[model samples]
Target: MGKLLTVFTPTYNRAYCLERCYQSLLRQSNRNFIWMIIDDGSTDDTKQLVEKWIEEDLIEIKYVWQKNQGMHGAHNTAYKLIKTELNVCIDSDDYMSDDAVEKITDFWMRNGSNNVSGLIGLDADLNDNIIGTKMPENLKKSTLFNLYNKYGVTGDKKLIYRTELTRSFPYPLFDNEKYVGLAYKYYLLDTKFEMLLMNEVICYVEYLPDGSSKNMYKQYVNNPKGFAFYRKELMKLPFVGKKFKFKQAIHYVSSSFIQKNRAFIVESPERYLTVLAIPFGLILYLYITSLVLHK
Candidate 1:
């Protein structure tokens, strides 16, 4: 009965670029959605701008502000507040196609079921080309993990999650670490249920030089606690294969060393694998250190 979808945007110090996302929402042919902005302690005029839009009353808006905690923390706040049946994330720098909401609601109303976790949609660039290969034409539903590992899907994609299911996997915030892989939640969700596959393009993306995607090396060194948590979680997934677990163990070793946690091998979910990866992890640790120092 309430709004069917909440398009939550987590932003920090991007008042200049936030308006484009606002304008795109304003143009939506279907406005059966709420625009919730998680303002991660922006010192800029982000709050003031969102207030002005609230006054305009053109769309539903819910804005919350908290001390800077990066994207994962912002997501933590949004999920706690969202009570809608469905939800999706449109980054502060990205916008949706005008009919994106219309298409999502229409499709879900016709086909959505609680048995599935959510829907998977496509993300495209500003030029309107799909960012990755389209969803497999014959596959009606698939886990997010299988889509990549089994079907060879690549590149960034848009995910629309069931609000409750998304809320079930809150990302663990580590001390002194503000960056965690957002996909950490998605991968966990993959272990529970499959998502309905939809080939429709839902949103547009443009990676900024300062965005996490562009600056992952720094994130790797600075957020070792968060990265280690992500890898440890992935290692525990029951559906993951040994090869995947070995790769995760390697990264886990690397992150643990960065965090100065020396007993990582003994504590690993796959202990023997972690022991095997120790040498490679040492090399990776040095490589990461050199990269950070080189920068």
Candidate 2:
């Protein structure tokens, strides 16, 4: 009876670029969605700006402020607060397409069901070029894991999830680390459900210089435990092949070294693989550390 979708954005001090996302929402042909902002302790004028937008009353907006926690923590908050049947995350620096809301709602209304997790849509760059290859036209549904590893789909795709599934596997926060792979929850979902593919570009993304994707070596150094936890989980996924598991084990070993976790071998979900990965992982750890140091 109410809005069927919640388009939530989790942000930090991204006030300068956040307006691009806000303006995009205002242009949506379908307004059957609400915009929820999780302000992850921005020191900038984010709160004041959002307040001004709220006063405009142009779109349904819900804003919540929390102390600085990383992106995953803000996601945890968004999942907790979203009350819609479906939800999607459009990052602070990314904006939706003009007809994105229309495409999503119309597609879901016709084809959505509880049997599937939700839909996977495309993301493009500012130049209107698809960020990577498009989804396989013949493939109607696949787990997000399979979409890349098996089906050869490339690039960052937009995910619209049922709120309940996302809330099921909340990411664990480390003592001082701010990053855990966002894919932790998504991988968990893959164990139970596959996502329907929609080859339309629903979101446009611009990778900012300060964005997390650009600073992975630093993130690896700072968030080793978090990275280890994510890799361990990925190693345990039932559907992936040994090659995939081996690769994850390599990362798990690297992260374990970074965090200096002595029990990584014993604690590993795949102990044998972890042992084999140790040499490569140590090299990777040194490589990452060197990159960070040189920077």
Candidate 3:
């Protein structure tokens, strides 16, 4: 019989952190799942580390290698190869709780419906502490934007989706803009059907200095061009047409721009002044973003 869930880990050169993730999977209460590792051209011993685990017969591990194409590329590869009804991703630096698979599987068995496109679970840290357990009481039918803006979907909450409904990440080279990349895609899916909120802690996110979120500020400072691309794409989404989208866009752009580039503005007056004439507010949010990047 085919496995019910496909757990994928999109890893770079995080051989040091992959062990915890593999160990977590080996400890899963429900073992009827496939572990797919999409290695993004790691120069480290990642391949050998995974091979060691595979030899132990710990779990059904399948490893694939590709050129250094970034997180989105690894994700796209995993989506194409995953052969299960449901899919979930835990970063290589992160691990899941022992009963996570069991909890997710049980939730699907009891409530999984053809109309339901996916499920969302609570996420925590390396210490097994829940980050956003205090989610809104009624999240089962909330739109993707509402979940993030209102309900506060921060940290690494594990979201399980139907393999068919999943879409590829739009931007592959987005540096500071990685957060909006996949998170927004999931929200777009909410436009068609609602995802179930399991309200249980399933995964733990490790705080690695090299992790995407850690270097977000530097990414913004170095490549304002990437932010411009992100802002343009954000406006193109259909959900962004809703009233909430505009408000969220304002908040998103202003916070990211000011927070990351304040130092640059002080150090390089001419560079910052070049884009200062651009209007502030929603009418010119995309324009200002482009100016910053181009300046």
lDDT of 2 at 295: 92
Task: Estimate, for each residue in 1-295, the C-alpha lDDT of model 2 and write its tens digit.
Answer: 6999999999999999999999999999989999999999999999999999999999999999999889999999999999999999999999999999999999999889999999999999999999989999999999999999888878899999999888999989889889999999998999889999899999999999989999888998999989999999998888888999999998999998888899999999999999999999999988989899999
Task: Give the C-alpha lDDT of model 3.
Answer: 0.71
Rank candidates, TM-score, best first.
2, 1, 3
lDDT of 3 by residue, 120-223 (tens): 88888767678855467665655556677677765556789998877544445653433335664676677677778778888888779998777655444444
What TM-score against the true fold does each predicted structure earn? 0.98, 0.99, 0.78
- Cand. 1 TM to true fold: 0.98
Q: What is the alpha-carbon lDDT for the whole of candidate 2? A: 0.94
Q: In model 2, where is the ten-residue run with the lowest total lDDT? A: 251-260
How far in Å is the alpha carbon of 232 misplaced in model 1? Answer: 0.8
Q: Each candidate: what lDDT? A: 0.93, 0.94, 0.71
Cα error, residue 146 of model 3, in Å, equals 1.8
What is the per-residue lDDT of model 1 for residues 1-295, given as tens digits with 9 covering 90 to 100?
6789999999999998999999999999999999999999999999999999999999999999999998999999999999899999999999999999998999999889989999999999999999979989999999999999999999888999999998887888888889988988998888788999989999999999878888898999999989988898899998989999999998999999998998887778889999999998989999988998998
Better of 2 and 3 by lDDT: 2
- Candidate 3 TM-score over all chains jointly: 0.78
